[model samples]
Target chain A: MSVRKTAFLALFTTFSLAVFAIEHAIPPLVPIPGIKLGLANVVTLILLRHFRARDAIFVLISRILLSSFLFGQALSLLYSLAGGLLSLCVMAAVMGLLQKKALFLTGAMGGLTHNLGQLAMALAITRTIGVLAYLPFLILSGILTGLFTGLCAGFAGKVLAPFLSDIS
Target chain B: MKKNTAWRKPAVIITAFLLLLSTASLLCLLARREKSDYAAEIFQDGVLIKSVYLNDISQTGTFIIQGENGCVNEIEIRPGSIAIISADCPDKLCVRQGFISDSKLPITCLPNRLVIRLRPVSDSSETTAVPDAVTY
Candidate 1:
């Protein structure tokens, strides 16, 4: 990759990490475990629009690792990593097949996938299947949150379209 | 991107999750409602050290259970509903997980091998906050 690409990826990853860290600091709007605005996802969605899928993957991996280190939660890194990868895969697959207008749908699906992945990891580590009880609540929250993040991504893409095209 | 009336994705996911929750609720309803035993066995080096039950818990704030390794495990029972409030472990996640009240689930700190399981009660009044299974 070119230096510019590397720099862009690094910048995007840092931006995502910042978003993730800040969101964690804020008290959860809902008492549910997986509910969150996931504002950081906007960067990934924007990248998917203007860049390649590989670029978005780079950003996602970097964000998960660096964010985990910053939080000093290395043990929990496995859960986050699995969840992030699954989410990115689902979002990218949906966005690639569906039209740009389905951004909200893609985001919601991504959020649900992410929570499922995390919950799976939790159950595996704890050696128990009891966590499946919260799936309904998590999915409901995911739909709401996914829609919000997707809208944010769409709005950002609209605002940047002209400049993005001009620069390219 | 073009948009269509493809609301099927979210609908399916939501339905699946709701079904799972209902199944859990059903299981909880079927299981006989009994009092919480609150009995916990503190084991170290594959040997049992002490077994403490809720009723016997004194008004004292904290008690230390000596493990075989001479590692004093400090257990703090907060008067009302006795739960393990803290432990010296890398991931304090289990500590923050609060209490367990069902036989199917146990709050475990992997690093410390400390397990806090809900012992089944023989009485008829106590209700478990969660079903005997783990909720996703």
Candidate 2:
């Protein structure tokens, strides 16, 4: 990768890590296990739009690993890894198939898959299928939060596009 | 780049479908209430450790469950509601989940491999109630 691209990714990684840490520090909005704003996803969506899937994946993995090391536990690390990877795959596919006009929908899809992935991990570890009842609640919250984050990314992309083109 | 409205149509349809599905599931969850004759079963490592009849219980009590790797969860049982009051798990998700009175949702401590589920009592003449589902 070019030095400029590497440096840009490093900057994005830092921004993502900061967002993750801040979100974690804030008290949960609800008592649900897998509900969160997922603000860092805005960065991922932006990266996927402006760059390549490979670059977005690198930044995402880095942010997950670094944030987990700094502020989360081993078990949470596993959950985040599973959720992040699944969400990334879904978002990448949506991006490729639908293009940028449907970025918000991609975000909603990512959120849904992310919750499913985490629920699957929870079911595996606890060995309980009854936990599947939480699926609907998770999906509801995922759609709302994902839409919010997706809109934020869309706005951020609009504001940064001109400056980014100048830099490149 | 050309501004296109084609993607909006599909996005709207998908979002509407998801909304409908979520609403239906929410209604089902809210409508399905277990009868008071249910029993709360505690499982550790997928093994039945304890079962308490919700109707029979007259007193509220808290008990500690020790699981693999020194994991501990303090479960609180009332006349009808059951909940995890405290736990050594990192996320404390089980604790944050509060209490449950129905069979629809099971409170689980994933890291500790502990599960608490409410199941309806069978009316058969058989004295022992066979588990409807095996967790593990």
Candidate 3:
């Protein structure tokens, strides 16, 4: 890979790690177990749009792995991996179909699928189906947070469009 | 730009639909209530370790369950609710979940491999309700 591309990936990875750390430091807005702003996702959405899916996935995996190592427990790593991969797949597919115009939609889809993926992991690890009860509440939170991050991503994409084109 | 606008219309419609569906589901979930006569079953590593009937309990009681790898959890049982008051797990998600009175969800400590679930006490007429069937 080119030095410039490598540098870009490193920079993006750092940005995402910072966002993840900051979000983690803040007390949860609601007492709900898996609810969060998912602010780092804005970076993921941006990377997915501005660069190739391969690059976006790399940044995502690196961010999750690094963040878990720094500020999370072993159990959290499992949940993050499941949620992160599911959301990434959903957002990429949605963006691929709808293009950049539907960035917010992609975000929302990612949010919902991310929660579902976590819940599935929770159910499996806990060995009880009762955890499914959190589905509705999780979905609602996912939609709201997803929409917020998606819009942020859309705005960021628009503002960075000219500069990003130069790098590519 | 023109193509973007066309996609935006469908996107908006889809978002609105999801919002409505989730809202309706949320309301339904909130409104659904579990029967008061039920039993709380505690499980460790997918094995049934203990069962307590909430209706028969009159006083609060607490017990500790130690799992593999030295993981410990303090489970509290009350008249009509059950919860994990404290745990040695790193996340303490089960403790934060607080008390649960219904069968809707269980308190789980993933690191400890501990699960506390409520199962409705079946009467003779309600025998048709499969105990193992996962509803919702």
Clashing pairs in 3: none
TM-score for chain A, candidates 1 onward in order? 0.91, 0.95, 0.97
For candidate 3, lDDT tens digit of each residue in A41-142?
Answer: 999999989998889899999998888789877577888889988999888888876766768888988888888898998888877666676788789888
Instruction: Give one clash count per candidate, in the order shown.
Output: 15, 0, 0
Give lDDT tens digits, candidate 1, residues B6-78: 6556555644654565465556645645445566555554456556565566674677654344433466664
Chain A of candidate 2 gets a TM-score of 0.95
Q: State iRMS for model 1.
A: 7.5
- lDDT (tens digit, per residue) of candidate 1 on A36-116: 777888888888877778888888888877777777354558877767788889888877655555577677777778877
- Provide the overall lDDT of each model, using Cα atoms, as 2-decimal numbers: 0.67, 0.81, 0.83
Question: What lDDT tens digits, residue by residue, belong to model 2 across residues A1-168?
Answer: 878878989999999999888888888666557889899999999988888889989999999888878887657777888888899998888776665776787888788778888888878876866667678778887777888888898899999888666433
CA lDDT of A19 in candidate 1? 86
TM-scores for the candidates? 0.59, 0.67, 0.66
- Whichever of 2 and 3 has more DockQ, that candidate is 3
Q: What tier of docking accuracy does candidate 3 attain? A: incorrect
Best by lDDT: 3
Q: Which segments of model 1 are wrong by more than 4 Å?
A: A29-31, A166-168, B1-136
